[model samples]
Target: MSKTVGAEGWTVVHQARQKHYDDRYYGQFLGTRKDGRWIVGRMWSGRSMDDGFHDGGWDWSKRFAEPSSTDAADAALKSYVEMSHETFVWNRVFEQRVGEAIDAYWAGPEVPGAPRLSAGWCRTPDGLPGGSTVGLPFHEAKYRLLQYLRSTESTARADLSPRTFNLHDAVELIRQANGPFRFQHGYNAYWLADDAS
Candidate 1:
């Protein structure tokens, strides 16, 4: 059986446990009643928080919009209707609004009683896909280890053949070296050992 709990204009539901899941991961699906429709418009409230997050005054009381589920639903309905009336339901209006909301959320004024998050990131050693590099990087020791491996293992020898090694072997090498490295575990790994099948 399932129950729908309301708050600050939102309907909160206990999401079903995923098959084969192992963690104590719990989440809620927030929905809005628009006209006669139950719209799961808002994103999932993350897979780790509590259902009581709604009742807890320390959550988003200060920063977030209206605090009543019914009111929140009404507001969402207005936003939905407005967004739907302009262009399509999925249009630049909603996109721009979402972007603005995200920007504002990040540039927070720091709610007086809200929980605080403290974190920082360094830069990646080789840069990211788009050629722009930045953000919380691995420990400097990891970079030094990578450099050492590259300098020593990047060479090709007549006796050294990719046909002799496999992705598992490479992973084992990393494990032996006590790595913070994770195998990419994709098509790239399939081609690592030349004849890996």
Candidate 2:
């Protein structure tokens, strides 16, 4: 039997466990009443001072907004959200905002606190797709491939069999490497292998 909790117009859809003392909280989801927008975030308090990431009085706080209900639903299923705000503030205003959000999410008739988070940075590796690179240039794609090889054990191989690399191949390789990646065009694969070697 799951106990339901709410406050203001927002509902607490999902709450993740606090695995470590340094972690203030993990994957938190707050959904609005009428709007489909959801606030998803996490906070690394660094209370233990293990990583020396203390900024004035606060550590890293990350928040993300999902506009569509479908995205919100998908996010609720995940253990933690991917992208996060790399910046930190001196005061606990950001922390307070998240607390208010949690309160409204559990308690009913008021608006939750909204934090003004700037555009976040991608903490992912150099070669991987940070988000979407649909219109990424071929030269850039080639550079990423080389970077990926340099970082990982996987080496680029030149295939002279004349077979086209599809989405499945790319996915399999990424799975083996245990990371995200972007693919270069078919014609550039041979040259990419040469560069990697």
Candidate 3:
């Protein structure tokens, strides 16, 4: 059996208790509501089942037997709806206002009793002067952020900070390491040299 924990801490247990109901390897699952029904199904990639797994596809009939009663279906459907709504809201909020959302979640009245997070500077594995254990090498992080910004929006770089700056450096390093740049966005657009970029 294999298990996975989602970002929200939901535990999904995939046990091979029955061959008929189990695929050779478990893939990601999503709980969703559709046509007034609640369902949990395997996410499939465009490739065949034998291919590597990718998170997508939610065909219900292949995963479970038909509901025994309308009441059961309704209850299941409601659960799926709630879960879907939660996931959607989380992603949307994180994408549009990550800083504000983080501030609200950590400091808001909802967490009145929560302890404050400690702040400090620490050395990296190689003992760089301003390094910390929490992030990747500065170059690597910057490259990844650059790639993300290119794919998403030009203003994405505005949110870059030391703590969240590794992704952009990573993308640039990868490009330089591999060969000449192939990305449509110019290297300067990421503003990698600027601390605030």
RMSD of each: 19.7, 18.5, 18.6
83-177: candidate 1 lDDT, tens digit per residue = 33321234455534432332222222333433222111111233222111122122222223222222233332213344533323442343233
Candidate 2 Cα lDDT to native: 0.32
Q: Give TM-scores for every candidate, taking all chains together and pairing residue i with residue i.
A: 0.19, 0.24, 0.20
Error of 3 at 106 (Å): 28
Clashes of 3: 26
**Pairwise TM-score winner, candidates 2 and 3:** 2
Rank order by lDDT, top first? 2, 3, 1
- Worst 10-residue lDDT window, candidate 3: 11-20
Candidate achieving higher lDDT, 1 or 2: 2
Candidate closest to the true structure, highest TM-score:
2
* Models ranked on TM-score: 2, 3, 1
| Range of the 10 consecutive residues with the lowest summed lDDT in candidate 2 | 114-123
What does candidate 2's lDDT look like per residue over 1-197, in tens digits?
11223233344443333334345432233333335445443334433333222231122232234654434433532313332222222133444343333323322232233211111112232343322223223333333443333222122232532354432344234223222233432322312222222
